[model samples]
Target: MIHEKFTKDSIISLSNLTVIKEIDDYTIGDEQKNIFFRVPREAVYVIEEAEGHNTIEEIQNSILQNKKIEIDVLDFMNTLNNLGVINNISLNEGHRNNFIKNLGKLLFNKTTVIFYIINILLTIILLISFPNKLTPNYQDTFVLSSIGLSLLLFFFVSWFLVFVHEGAHYLAVSATGKKMNFQLSIRWFWVVIEANMNTLWSISREKRYIPFLAGFFIDILIINVSFILILIINDIFVISLLKMVALIQFYKIIWQFIIFLRTDFYYVLLNYFGVSTLTKGSISYLLRKISSKYSLFFDQLSIREQIICKRYSWLYVISLFAICYLFLFFSIPTVFHTLKTTLNILSAFAYNTFEFWDSFIVIALIFFEFILWIIAAYKRFKRGD
Candidate 1:
């Protein structure tokens, strides 16, 4: 009985899997485990033949007869089994709900697409019509009744917008029949809410674009609505608040385009090139070029990957320099000036005064943001991410 079970004639039990064809390879994997592999066309044929009805020997015979190529049937079966792709499993629905799924689909329909385009065009027209609002002013951030209250309001509203951004990514992933996991994380010095859409690997490359760009799309929508409200609202306070909201949304959209920060556009570029480790690989490639000590790391990459890394290294280097320069000159100076001004205000005003409270609030907000960044960074380090 044991010998018979081990024979090539034994039926193969393939797990539920998703297979997508890329430009040069096929992406096949078990979505339940969030594991995927890029294989050649021939490997896809082998996988297709692994239905329960076919025995291992029969699958090999069929492939050989059709493609005139030989493959080790038992070895392939073992490989799949090791990868947990030869087991029975179902899609994990514990994190998903029907309402979110339906809403996700609704948000990406043809009607919504038309509105998205219209919103973008209208926003451009408004910006052109009112060129004064094109530049963002820091004064807009303090448009509320009191400076302290305005600062608090901006903090809460900024976080609310961040939630909406991540929510858009979640909805887009749901639309593609996948669920997303979100985490409060830090990117460089900024505290960010990130959505992990790794399950998207199971879908086609083209379908992944919307989920990646969804945050930007929603930001644009918010900016468009804010601009419209600013035009219609006669009250100065309301107009100022709307302009501030629009300015923040505009900043979010621009931030997404900073590819070096591994923003949405960065992922879009990775998907377009069908390269998974372009950023890491590019950095390794540059390091290897700088010294022989890094040769071992660069040599670990395949020849094709090496070429890709070499090609992308220049862009990475340039972006790195640009970011370093910006941080040293713009960001550092802005921080010092803000801190100096807040300290002066605090010293000039009595503790009972609104001016003193405003400076206190600014310091408290800065400290709060710093604490969040520290926690996020610690969590990231613990996870080895």
Candidate 2:
């Protein structure tokens, strides 16, 4: 029988998935799959033995004599071949190469990096020296407009900034000369900009930091540019709008600290620590202490996983509380306050009056966020992840 061989790029890494031990993990990038898979230790040895120099009988006989175990060489070779590890076919290798090459052309060089640092420093100085002037008056955005118009403006500006943020991330990834997969999806209330981060392993640890943070930098850039525009534009309406956008950007920056949301900062911390599954593993570690089911599965984790869990469990708890605090203190209160106040104002006007309709629209928009949370929760429940 013909013997299949491991590709030259096929690498066997000792992966620590559980708290107890290391396991064989395979990375076969030559086929352009760009995925890692855990495999049985014996399977790894079998692939190693199948170097194509030995026939199936010769390989199996050698293993049996050395380890005294029965083996099926054909099935094993077929399994590895099926997994794309043997590189039997060329799959998008050219596309992947071209993408990285093109991305190299768009990356920010050393000069641009210096400029970014200077820009951020200036923004900090300006914000410190003139907080009141730079601060946004959210009231100007909603109080002066009809409910419908305010909602439209808010969404337009918010989405515009969001796109720019994602674009910054795209450029950051490209700068590293790596392939990235970017997609737009809505999960419950927020439009999420999802970027596939599997290939992050291929880049240097320091370089990975920029892609995670590029979005926030882009946000700061926009805020600074808007500040300059604010100085030049005399129109009160345009000035107010810019201030509002700037305010929202400020809020988003603070929102990064709420780690339970798995914001950009969370990823940065995870990358810095060199852990793959911090939150999930930490939560599972906590769960294992309370239940047998959790323990049974958790016991399978490697030592690295256990360490990640122990190290991050406190953070997980703090982030959980932070999420609750924000929800209860901010989200719940704001929605209720807005709804109650709007209803009272509407009661003072006839239902057919513009004042009543305006108030009604505000209430609807407020509830939109709550509706999104409900939808997202329901989705998670159904998927059982």
lDDT of 2 by residue, 320-362 (tens): 6656655665456645655676778787888887778877777
Query: Candidate 2: worst 10 consecutive residues by lDDT?
Result: 14-23
RMSD versus native structure for model 1: 4.5
TM-score of each: 0.80, 0.67
Top model number, lDDT: 1
Candidate 1 C-alpha lDDT tens digits along 1-385: 0122235877865547678877667788877766788887888787788777888889999999999989888877777766666664344546668898899989975567678888889888888898785544556666775666787887898889989988999988998888768877787878988788878888889898888888888999999988878878899988887877876787676666556788887888778877666887777777776777567778887888788778877766556665665556445654665677688888776888777887898889889999999989988888677
Return the lDDT, model 1, position 35. Answer: 72
lDDT of 1: 0.77
Cα deviation of 50, candidate 1, in Å: 3.4
The lDDT for every candidate, in the order shown, is 0.77, 0.62
Model 1 weakest 10-residue run by lDDT: 1-10
lDDT of 1 at 66: 95
